[model samples]
Target: MLNFVEYTTQSALRNAGMRSVISFGIALLFFAATLVSFQVTDASAQSACFERTALMKHLSGKFEEAPVAAGLAANGSVLEVFSSPDGVTWTIVLTQPNGATCVMASGESWMGMKKPKKDKVS
Candidate 1:
């Protein structure tokens, strides 16, 4: 079994990977979308899109997920993380400027982290 510190480290690394995926998705969807045959149909978008409050309610009520981290981008988009209690499951959501909230990704085995302390000098 992993100890708390070790688990936190692992979780942080996994979270970083998730962020990398989000970045890749942004690049693919915004920059190189034309290079690929990717398409966001209205039906697909409708399934994923929701009002911010509604999405929050659904996540909390259905999965017991709560916001773990959230931030706003320069383009007025918001990236938010919702995780189940005990760090077992998680979701990454993006809220666009027009108030469309969508689940960008989700997975299990979320691990919470403690605040990092400054390193000591020898």
Candidate 2:
């Protein structure tokens, strides 16, 4: 009968709608779990070297990849030269993956007296 056919079609549509909602919810949950996992792993990470060029420029020198402690994973390139005020003192800035910057000074470089933090106008 026409009534029976109509009922069956409506039931099918309702089931399809429920399935879509369930699928969407499951997908959202999966995405959330993935983001949480990435955050956890990234927080404890030590290397973040994607902006190598910018970091090198900020250090004011060139860097060549070199070995480091903590096995091969911990090793990175060292910055050979970084220019600061005073001809003598060259600050070597080392970039680490864990978003840590380390500075080392060459003994030949003299720090001289404290200069005001202001820049010299051209």
RMSD of every prediction: 24.1, 12.8
**What is candidate 1's lDDT per residue for 71-100, written digit by digit as tens?**
999999999999998878899999988888
Over the stretch 13-33, how does candidate 2's per-residue lDDT look in tens digits? 999999999999999999999
Quote the lDDT for 65 in model 1.
Answer: 98
TM-score of predicted model 2? 0.37
Best candidate per TM-score, number? 1
Residue 71 displacement in candidate 2 (angstroms): 12
RMSD of 2: 12.8
| Model 1 residue 76 CA deviation in Å | 1.9
* Superposition-based RMSD of candidate 1 using all C-alpha atoms, in angstroms: 24.1
